[model samples]
Target: MAADLYPSSPAPSAASQTRFQKLRKRLHKDRALLLLALPGILYFLIYKYLPMFGLVIAFNDYSPFQGFFGSEWVGLGQFRKIFSDTEVLRVIWNTLFISFLQIVFAFPIPIVLALMLNAVRNQLYKRIIQTVVYLPHFLSWVVVIGICVLFLKSEGLINEILKSIGLPAIPFLTDPAYFKPLIVGQVIWKETGWGTIIFLAALAGVNPNLYEAAVMDGANRWRQTWHITLPSIRSTIIILLILRLGSVLDSGFEQIWLMLNPFNKDTGNVLDTFVYFKGIEQSDYSFATAVGLFKGVVGLILVMGANYLAKRFGEEGVY
Candidate 1:
């Protein structure tokens, strides 16, 4: 029994040799593509994966002066404090509300835009419109928000137009009521075009003959879209949706941080803002890291659950 086996003691078996040979052949064939991907692989390894070791700070009562390992280990104490806060409920409510709005109002606009653009038969008009929409996606958050300020402020263009029409200048920036809508609207305007690109690619892969057949069967554009276009891109939609769910809790920091004020603090305080304030502004790194870890864990669970549901429904989900 003692001599029965030790792993890696024996020489490679025939099946193992064949598998190794096949793998070597594949590597040789795909070497050029792998070389092209080398920079991206190194980028992730350096910037993304390597930094995951910093998560240790989440379990410590961390201080920069104390260094990573030198920090006192509190192990979940920070998490407990997070949930124990009386304002935590309000913060959670604000985060969920914004996230929900983004998913419902922002996510689908891309698909709709893609579909509408796809319907345009005039190539020049379509390209022009695409260029116009795509411009916003390239704008930095600071510039984007500045444009919003220029348009939506009390003395801004929008209010000027309203004043000219004998209407009151609405408190769009200061009012809590407008905060969530403004955020959602900003996201929609900035990202909707960029998001549509993927759906358009999926749409391009669709068989044109399907549309022709549908027209032959007396189907209108709407009918063709319903019967062919939407169904063909169903997988893409499912994949994007599953991926979206993974980031549902990550309400952005820079945009919200800029827009957030005493006026809209009740509605605008999201997880990202909370992390910035707690971690950077207040120097409570452990608490902030704990909150971030909590968000990440929830995101992972949501993604896993969504992927499971998609597979159950016979769809190929994002792995």
Candidate 2:
């Protein structure tokens, strides 16, 4: 009765062995490719992952002279300081606010630009437009800010034009209220064309047949775009958005630092600037490390959460 009810155990299949053999064969075939990738692999190990061990300083009252091993351990002490400091909290607020503005306003400009370019029938005009827009991206922040100061300073070109037009001059750079908008505007102007490159590439991959079929079905250009063009690039957009969410706290350090001044410091003080002031100028390495570590942890959590949400929504994520 037992034998009838329970079948005898079958012999183990050689599937595992076969897979191992296949993997070995594939590795041998891709040896040259692996060799080509070796430098990049080493770079991550040496610069990225290996340096992670230094994060231990975040938990201690570290001193450069005392060294890593000799530094007195004050676990979570710096983190406690960060939470208790109103200034730090304010900085966090500024960072989040700027990053939010960027995500909401700056992120979509490239897509819109790409769509407009895609709709253009004249390739020469499109190329000229693209080249002009892309030129700003190559300019360093110092140069960009210099150009901004030249145009946006109180007595600069913009105000001169406004005066000629009998309109009052706007405080584009000096006012705290205008600071964030200025930052977002700068971001859009500098990076929109560069960002469009990726979207334009993705759009190129979208089948022209989809548009042809839509046309045959009596769909207008707007309807074809809404139904066909956008859907085709949906996955690319989602993946990029997920990646953007990962850096939600990283308001550009160089851009903000170059633009930062006493007048707009209240709205412009972000994590990177905070770290620079504390670590470099003030020589408070431990607290600076703690703040940086905290930022990294938050970034990791955000990336993981975004990836999860993306997967849940049936989109391919950056994982």
Query: Each candidate: what lDDT?
Result: 0.87, 0.89
Write one digit per residue (lDDT tens) for candidate 1, span 1-319: 2122223323567868977777778989999998998778777766786557789999998889999999999988888988898666678778888888999999999999999999899999999999999999999999999999899999999999999999999999999999999999999999999999999999999999988888899999888889999999998898788777777887877999999989988789998888888888998888888888888888889889888888887887668
TM-score of 2: 0.84
- The residue pairs that clash in candidate 1, if any, are none
lDDT of 2 by residue, 51-130 (tens): 68788889999899998768999998999999999999999999999999999999998999999999999999999999
TM-scores for the candidates:
0.82, 0.84
- CA RMSD (A), model 2: 10.0
Which residues of candidate 1, in runs, are more than 4 Å off?
1-51
